[model samples]
Target: MELLVIVGVFFLLCAVFFIRTVSKKKAVDKAVDVDKDDSYAFEAIGALFTAAERSFYGVLTQSLKDNYVLLGKVRVADIIKPQGNLNRSEWQTAFNQISRKHIDFVICDKDNLSILCAIELNDSSHNKADRAQRDAFLSRALSSANIPFVEFTAKRSYVIRDIQNELHQFLAQQSSQTPSADTKICPCCSSQLVERVSKRGKNQGNTFWGCSAYPKCRYVEES
Candidate 1:
């Protein structure tokens, strides 16, 4: 009986030890997981724009002036979003393409601040294979979004008149299509037709009538 009692106590102690060990191991694993969850801290950097970019900003600003709002370093993801029935993986893949790329310049509406066009300053770096591929991807994405895109080679000297003319023509093309009174109402959202510029694609720089409540109303009519 004593021997049986001793075995029982031994088994009980073993069970208690095993339970404590597993609990301690679980606690350690959780602590390690918490440590793994820690993220890298960031530090402040210097100038956001490179010397080439800074020089171009002056030229772009002077060119745009009060006619349009020129914004620098706008992200592609912000300007273009995935459409259609996208699975999580597909959406993630699309997002990954543009997440890191930024447009050198974005021209927006002076009043409502809607994006009108994007510009890329093609420096020598753009000649590289990786940059070329990136440029092509960005171009396709922008085109798909029906946003107009322009590219200019880096130049030591930029003509203000040339910039002005380019912008003027591009903007003019956007609102060139006028909607008739009968078809002015948007079929999608029942909003009134508003004058808008095509910012990208084959019809880029073409002026077309769009939905007044756009971004919500995507209806478009050719003038």
Candidate 2:
């Protein structure tokens, strides 16, 4: 009888201990659930431009306000399109290339926002051969579209008068030369073909009909 009594007491104690442990586990799980709910968050960041880029962007904006609208960090794909006889895979590749590249600034018409010129600020990094090659590629792309392209060395201050004079000269030159209507259109993108002047290698200074959507559409024809 004593043994039976002790066994009953032990079972009761075991049951109580099991219940307490389950209750504690449930409480812990509830606390963890609350923590998870509060965990997701984000914070504010500073300006996207560097000190030099910001200063030049301000100058460029102010200088262009009168005649042209200035757009910063414009994507190459936005201003240009791919046009040519391209298969589906080739078309995708062209679009991917243009999507990866960007122009620093684009000057557009105040009335219609048509791109007038593209500008690249050449910092010390641009002195590297790779950067120079990239710059040359961008220059050719703009030229092929009959859009004026200009490069400026980054500085703390800029002469607005010099910028205005250079733009005037480029606009005047563009007005003299026009893209031929008979040039073939790119199958990938409908943009027209414009004559581009070669700036490097053995074909330096030679003109060719290149798709307006340069890096995006690389179709070229001899002029």
lDDT of 1 at 62: 82
Question: How well does candidate 2 match the true structure, expressed as C-alpha RMSD?
Answer: 11.3
lDDT of each: 0.78, 0.73
Off by over 4 Å in 2: 1-45, 171-223
Give one digit per residue, the lDDT tens place, for model 2 in 1-223.
9999999999999999999999999999999998889677877667766788788888877665454678888999898766677888987887786787888888775544667678888899999999999888888776665567899999868998887786764333221133466646656666556666776678978988765554445677888
Report how far residue 148 has shifted in candidate 1, in Å: 0.9
Encode model 1's per-residue lDDT on 132-208: one tens digit a residue: 99898888888777676888889998998988787664564232234555646777866557566666668777878
- Give the number of colliding residue pairs in candidate 2: 4
In TM-score terms, candidate 1 sits at: 0.67
Query: What TM-score would every model get versus the actual structure?
Result: 0.67, 0.57
Model 1 residue 132 CA deviation (Å) reads: 0.8
lDDT of 2: 0.73
- Reference-based TM-score, model 2: 0.57
